[model samples]
Target chain A: MSECIVITSGKGGVGKTTTTANLGVALAQQGHTVAVVDADIGLRNLDVILGLENRIVYDLVHVIEGECRLKQGLIKDKRLDGLSLLPAAQTRDKNAVTPDQMRKLVAELKEHFDYVLVDCPAGIEQGFKNAVAGADKAIIVTTPEVSAIRDADRIIGMVEAAELPEPQLIINRFRAKMVQSGDMMNKEDILEILAIPLLGVVPDHEDIIVSANRGVPVAFDDESLVGEAYRRIGRRLGGEPDVPLLDLTVDDGLWTTIKRWMGLAPAREVAR
Target chain B: MSNPAPARVGGGAPVVVRTLSAQSGADGVIVSVRVDVAFDDVRAELHRVLGQTPERWRNRMARLDLGDRDVELFDVRRLVHLLKGDYGLSVTAVYTTERAVHRYVSRELKLQVFTRDPADDCVQALVGAVGEAGATAVTEVGPHAIDSDGVTEIVSGPAVTVEDTTSFETDDDVVEDDGAIADLSYDDESGAAKAAPEPEPDVVLPVEPMPIRIAGGQRVQSIPRSLRGGQSVRFPGDVVVYGDVNPGAVVEAGGNILVFGALRGLAHAGSHGDEAAVIMAFDLRPTQLRIGGRIAFQGLEDDIPRGPGFRPEIAFVTDERIRIEPWRGRLPTEQVATGDAPPSTKTPGDAAEAAPVTEQ
Candidate 1:
């Protein structure tokens, strides 16, 4: 039986779409047929990240309306054989599909696929309801910032109310260096507040931005730290054993040398 | 589809199989097949078809008998396929058997046999049985009853009287023809109309209103500027510093105050205020101190420490007496450079330095 999972976060710009795209690619690489559904509707970006924007002739809305068959609307990934995408319509609003219709569509898709991953929209609204209506499980993405954690807590409450199964948390854009320096909140602090199982952490990396711009998920790039992290997340979801977190500690000598060479380091302010 | 040839025996009287086919165009087909045979042989045949002996077949078949056994087999898969495959016959039917005949036909042979019984129609028979037992057998409701009749009845009497005496008022006035009153009158046998007289006007004597007292304390009006005395004046709450209190002004506050620059004002610690309330200044040169209800004047004998130019200082009641202290302490830069301080406390100093400072 197929398991539908929704990747969501209450706050925007927390890498929900990026996580969705990367996880889809990673799961597909494992030979599981995966379909990534972008439920952001009018503000669709999953297609762009997957680099399949130009190929989207018929979208989710069209398929739901019987204007096109599901097979016709599904965009097969050029890079990954087992991964496909059902892009949201940019012209239509979120109201175009109801939760019941989404449930029906997902039920129909469950017969043919092993995993259906949905990219949920920001905020706990109708779009969120529609995205999670058919999902068997959920993945909540959050940053270590106070506002992001607070919003994630609210989203967790909402998901609980919807009667969905427990949601695992993926801390995104975590700067381990800052966290070590006490400048940012740590993983334990976020998890303690959210009270959810930690899936895997995706460190902040420039390669992610580059890959996203190129419409290729970083998971395909084995050399990238974030790409490896995404792959580990996929494995964990596949019921694999625990994987260690990425060591983000930079060498003190290297950090100091770089700072000294750039003259960007500030002298400690003295007060009496 | 054609029906299979009947099983035959040459010794006994020729058994004629009469097949009655009724094609109710819209309603559906009802075909009946009658066969005459011995009772013992028919029982064995039923056992073979149902895949169980008599005891095991009880749940499968509702009614059974030795001779003239009327088995209402509804849409039997093996029998229907036989009828369609061998004999080109498409019909629904009920079968009635007065006797049993199990003359074995070849394994390859197929027969289309219809039994005239309610059980011949799968859905119809099941529905009919459930209906006969007066049970609502809906697909969705299953065995669970959809509607229940056990309802709770609330025994209600006259409502409890809750008199709102606070809002009640009595009025006395000359009787006037106004429709304001409710019509509580009932018809008399004589058809004569009668009405109750209006109530007398009530006189409400005015009572003295209670004095309004502030919850915390009375607001202290602004102190007169001309009433300047070096004697420390303590307040119960905030002291509003309107003008510059000179170094010898010796003003004290119970809480906090806003001083508009040049706090050369010798504000004493704690006026009528709590002892913990402090005296702050852009420049700290207080001549006297007082906290709560206590007053302490600066003596000539007390030695004061010279600062590396005191920027701002706040003096509060410490050790049960006012003590002046400088506000400077270890800064963020010093902490970061030393690395001895907790790393978490070391945020970029620029962000910390940008924090707004308010004097009150």
Candidate 2:
């Protein structure tokens, strides 16, 4: 039984694309056949994030419009086996595809892959609607900001209204040091408003940005904490509910390290 | 464009601009434009000088002090158009010594003109302006308008005139229409007539307060689910919701509004005009609260901070203004006696006190 999940965040720049790319690699690394479909249409980024941008001869639009077969559009990941990408059309508008076409496409992809992950676009527009059309479940992504939470709450309401099962949440770009200092919001604050099940929280780290710039998914690196975070979330999505959350506070160290950076602590001998 | 040779202007004289200085005035600025060039260059040079004003000065009323040059009627018209259209300045009055310009600009453009009298007529208007209310002018604060020891400043230009005597210590907040105030006084008309009254500077038309109306609810609407952003519920009667009202959602009713859960959205009770309408929420952190025509924006961060932590609040009109206080419980059954006072110890305000007999 293949379950297709659409990863969405109503607000842009909240890591919908990054979550889709990393989770796809995480699932593929677990030896499961996965096909991550980019539903952002004109703003297709799953191909770029998965480092499969250059190899696209056909796209989701071509598949939907019957110009090419579904196999012609699926780009295999450069690094991992059993992982493929159905990239959205860069030249076509979002209106080029319909919700029925997406449902049909996902139904076909499910026959070949174990799991199909659809990367949704930002906003509650037509592209968002088309992305949600084919998904069996949804994974909402949000940051610790008020605007992100507000939009997430709105997206959750929309997902329920669309009759999708209670969507799980992934709080991305979390900074533990800021949340610990009482400056930023913690997981409890977001969960209180959203009242949804938590898939995981990806700590804000340089690895994600470095991977994005280098056209590589962070999930390829097993040592990175953020990579582990995505891997845990992937396991949760894969029906392994016992995967524990990663310890994000390991980077925040003690107060001395914080004070030393601020040049406020008393002179302590440098150990290193 | 390569810094053209000292340009020969009117009367075959190659004139050049001398100095330019700006002084901050009430709600705007007063620019003292001193130039040896003729009046034809005032508009062109004004652009070069005041083109990129400070961020605050942009779109504000700017005063320009054009030198005592031969200002024709057409010159005033073009200068007014350029200053208004190009620089976004509201020129209030024009002061000129040319009696003929005084005749035409006042008749054709309807601009006010003033003389450079330091002691007699100028001081009389200053005293009158100071008496017209406790209007706080910059003159009283910095005392920059007038020089003590009874001395007037003769700013060097086409004509030596008292420039500081014009920036008055008068009704600083009075508002007036658009026209430039040129201060070129002639010895012939020094004591001939009164100075054109200072432009009315400060009178922003105050918005009239919305009058609260009296009306009862016709029906009661019950909503079982939470309202998300872009969703709204409007009814002609009271509204009761069983779920949270998320941000960007709206709940409007003609009578009272009660939310069982948090209200992060907007709640407008008394939509028709019931001033006695009250809004009670389990966790009241609405973006805006409206009781009748009165509106109170939840702008203060301390009043309704985002995130979790509930201290149920009830909003009602109590002294012509909507006031919010802690809500203990609702007396929905009318069980309390009419004459009995509300228990002040445990309750800040009960729902019975906020809801009047609107069912007339």
TM-score of every model versus the real structure: 0.43, 0.60
Reported per model, the fraction of native interface contacts reproduced equals 0.00, 0.32
Query: Model 2 scores what on Cα lDDT?
Result: 0.66
Clashes in each model (backbone N, CA, C under 3 Å)? 26, 18
Q: Looking at model 1 chain A, which ten-residue stretch has the lowest summed lDDT?
A: A263-272
lDDT per residue as tens, model 2, A1-272: 89899999899999999999999999988889999999999998888888888899999999999999999999988679989999999998889988999999999999999999999999998998999998999999999999999899889888988899999999998887777677888888788788889889998888998999888899988778788889988888887987865666544456447666788743331100
Best model number under DockQ:
2
Q: Is the docking of candidate 1 incorrect, acceptable, medium or high quality?
A: incorrect
* Cα displacement (Å) at residue A111, model 1: 1.7
The DockQ score of candidate 2 comes to 0.31
lDDT of 1 by residue, B1-360 (tens): 122122222222111111111111111122212234443433333323222111221211121111124321221333444334433333233233211111000011122222223223222332232333332121110001101110100000111011100111111110021111112111111114323212211111111211111125643323433112232344434455544444434554434433433344356332322333445555544455544334456676643543556565555554545555654432223223433444235321221222111111
Each prediction's whole-model lDDT (CA): 0.54, 0.66
